[model samples]
Target: MGGPEQQVFHPNANIVRKAHCSSMEQYRQMHARSLERPDEFWGEIAEQFHWEAPVKSNFFSYNFDINKGPISIKWMEEASTNICFNLLDVNIQKGLGDKVAFYWEGNDPEDYTRVTYKKLLEHVCKFANVLKSHGVEKGDRVAIYMPMVLELVVTMLACSRIGAVHSIVFGGFSADSLAERMHDCRAKILVTADGVWRGDKLLHLKEICDTALDKCSKIGHNVEKCIVVSHLTRLSNAHTQKTPGMKPPVHKTPFTPGRDLWWDDEMKGASNFCYPTWVDAEDPLFMLYTSGSTGKPKGVLHTTAGYLLYAATTFKYVFDYHPGDTYWCTADIGWITGHTYVVYGPLANGATSVMFEGTPFYPHNGRYWEVIEKYKINLFYTAPTAIRALMKFGDEPVKKFNMSSLRVLGSVGEPINPEAWLWYYRLVGQNKCSIVDTFWQTETGGHVLTPLPGCTPMKPGSATFPFFGVQPELLDENGKIIRGPGEGYLVFSKPWPGMMRTLFGNHDRFETTYFKKFPGYYCTGDGARRDEEGYLWVTGRMDDMLNVSGHLLSTAEVESALVEHPDVAEAAVVSHPHAVKGECLYCFITPNEGVHFSTTLVAELRKKVREKIGPFASPEVVQHAPGLPKTRSGKIMRRVLRKVALNDRDVGDTSTLADEGIVEALFSNRPPEASKLLKAC
Candidate 1:
């Protein structure tokens, strides 16, 4: 399937007026040098940070070819440094101590906090001491499950400060999911909050943690201590009387006398001058679990020096971030985007960052716009799913806010359709700000393929170019590399600094999953195409590709075509078994607000798909969906959709979904004929 190339959007003269890399020529030269002389290029970047002991030997070594040995990658092997120290102490020594490290926006717009670098250090150090007092030491695992608050960031830094590997579970995850992750990491201590507020609902986080801990105990993995942050309780206590239409104050939090310790109580007696624990560059910094194809989650492990250096460098160049720019990335600290961008990246560059603790639609559909206006945010990074969700409400919510302060906008998590990209550019960016559509994964710690805001010209639906030092190549099904303007599997010919070293506690699995597919290349597990201009457009995952009567069609391509229709807010496409065609496209579409779904609309959508990607790509079944099943982070749960489309009774793990009821609703709404087909099979 093919369509006309999208019109390219160049950087606005005003937007790139003060960019670090002003022209495409400069970016090309720098990227070429990064690949030609990696050691020199990376060494210079490494010097920007504070290293306890610099590398005495080779800067990096790798073995992507399994025939050589176990698949491995090591960067700055002979160096020693503390990621927290570089992110905090180094910046403080550079006279950024009084600068605002984080502008924390709470769930309620009225509640906010600004934390200076000096104050952040004090809090992180004190919390580090608290972890030490509870027997947490170097290499120990600490599980953090808390809401989006200043304390959560403090806990992450604290773990890094004392060389304890932290695993942050998203607050919205079910207790069983939390327990599975905690058990996988064999966490010794658990950090959580009393409760959290999402929109108008109050979720008891402590109760969830208690349940997770109980599940962990049953699995023979016991947490020695649980540190509880009384965030909501403190808010409730401060406001003596309840406000009209607000939930009642949360007064009591269940506690296990010996194992549970209040966060404030531990901080009161802890010292604020705990020294950083230096470790090898290759040492594990954090472990984040991501869903695997086999129904089990795999822990993607990242190291210290390489991960930090990559995050900082990419943050500086990708967003064209200036020194005093107030950057905001609307991602919870639980995800890799938050870990690299929100905490490590901007801070490492001494840039002011915004941390928000609620959904984009919470309080109102305009919450995100309000936060941007309130903070005068310069660089804003968010997901395409969120952008699409906000698009359903029309432009009124965003138009009311002053987005003139924005210089650069970014889209992550998934490939953005042209329609949503145009809406974000026309309304949110005001047609002046550049949109950098980044393409990477949890396995890759930072951006791999993305347009440089000030350098590469933007394409609405394409990632445009690879980041510095990323060598991207497309390969056919037989593993032979496809030269130019062809669609195939996307893979990297070489390793980047931010690439995950291995799966925690399972090195063999890591090798087999990523390296086994292409032998010498790192298989990205996604299909992509390079246009005539060399801009790469990522089609969805390989598994999402459908084969119909010898014709191959990408679900992302069809979904993008479906979303291009004005009435469709979002669309998810999955393949269903068909006796005649081998497989057929099954689409779940959510219409825009106030738009009625009917046969006319469905026919219009199918026509749009056929026009965009040819007749073979037309979806066989079109189901009206009130809402697509998404994770708390705004990623469409396509697996659940696939299961529901097939009318499978056992829809695997809906725990990570934002609303499990959406799955049930989808199943209930499945066409009667489709249900019959499943039963007949």
Candidate 2:
């Protein structure tokens, strides 16, 4: 399916006039310079941060061609720096210590906290000392499994301060998922919370930690220490009335005599000052595990200096951030987006960020807008899934709030559909704010293809162009580059500073997965097409492309068409094994609130897809779903949908799902008509 070929919305004149790169010509010139003179462009940007010893000779070197040498990429090889120091100390030294670092919005609407740069440094130092007292030295792995609390951010920075590589597992992950990650990383210590309130439910995190540790011990991978933060107790102390749908917070959690320690007790005796551990630029900063095609998760590792520079640079330009802009990225710290935007990138730039600890639907549908208005948030970044979900509630919830403070809006996690983009632009932004459709992945530390808010004109469903130094090209199946206006696999022709160093402990897998595909290009595993305007459109994952009776179709294109039907809130398109047509589309759709799913609705959805993507792309089975299974990060679990469509007994891992019950619900809620159609598969 083809993407939008022409610009739909021009950048807001007011924003463009005040932007860092005020004109398209200026942006083009800077982008050209970034590609032509890579070392000079990046070296100048790197100088903005503090480095112990700057690179004297080669700033960067890489060999994507595995045949020429072992696949390698190194940046600022001779430099040494501390990410924690640059993010905190540098900003403090610049007299920004009294500025709010993070505005924490807790699950309860009344519960909130403002942490300043100096206060954050004190917390980080205290936590670093706590880790040190527990024998967590440099190079040791620390697994952090906690909710979206202020302490979570502090723990990450603390790990960086002590030169410990942190692997943050999402709090919603099951004990098995936690155990697997801890085992893979061979973590020496695990930091957790007693319990956390998500909406109304209180998740006993310390109990989950205990179970994970037991599983790890059984597997001969023992985590020596577990530090527990009493988040629930703190919440209880803050509010006299208990939150609805949640039981009163427990006074204390079950603890082990030798291994378990309390966060409050440790901080009582811990010093508020600790020295930053200087690490090589090439040293790993964090390893975030992402789901792989093989059912196992891949630990995507990002280095210090390069990742910091790229994240900070992208944050400044993509969001058009100012010194006092109140930025908020609604993502959990476990994900790469939160690492780059919510904590590291914003802090490194000395920007105030919002760290929310709840869902969009909780308390009310207007919760997100309420937070925005309450904080007067200037730059708002969130996933398209959230946008679509909120769209189901209609515009009243959003229209009631004052979003006048919003200057720039951002879409992440997935490619946004035209309908959702228009809604976000018209309703939430009031047609004044610029929308930055960011496209990147866990492997890429920062944005790859995106529109600079104030520079590039917005296209409803397009990523627009590549970020600085990101040379993206479309490559055909035969390994030949598709120069212009063609559809093929998306790959980067050259390496950027933010690219992942390697899959942790799996250099061969990294080489084969990214480099072996096209020989000399870093494979993005995504399919895309370039419009006549040279704007790139990421269709979906390459595997999501289906060949229906020799007709190639992208699932994203089909889903977008289905969602345009007005009655549908969200749709996930997957393929089931077919006998006649090589493969047929199996669609699971969640109807909008107050809209009932009926035979008429199903037929209309199929006709919508046919009209948009041709008859071959029409879904054979349209299953009515109450909800689509999604990870806590709001990414739909398409793999689970594919397996369920095939009626496969082995549905793989459900541990990472935000709501495991949704899987069973999808199976049981399959309409009879859908079952009849699915039989042909």
* lDDT, each prediction: 0.90, 0.90
Q: With candidate 2 superimposed using the best TM-score fit, by how many Å does residue 36's alpha carbon deviate from the native?
A: 1.3
Candidate 2 residue 452 Cα shift, in angstroms, is 0.5
Point out where model 1 deviates above 4 Å: 1-5, 241-248, 676-681
Error of 1 at 53 (Å): 0.8
Q: Write the per-residue lDDT of candidate 1 for residues 109-183, one digit (tens) a residue.
A: 877879999999999999999999988999999999999899998999999999999999999898998999999
Error of 2 at 540 (Å): 0.9
Model 2 TM-score is 0.97
Predicted candidate 1, C-alpha RMSD: 1.7
lDDT by residue for model 2 (358-448), tens = 9998899999999999999999999999999999999999988999999999999988998899999999999999999999999999999
lDDT of 2 at 328: 92
List the candidates' TM-scores in order. 0.98, 0.97
Mark the 10 consecutive residues where model 1 has the least summed lDDT. 237-246
lDDT score, candidate 1: 0.90
Residue 444, candidate 1: Cα error in Å is: 0.7
Q: In candidate 2, how many Å is residue 445 off?
A: 0.3
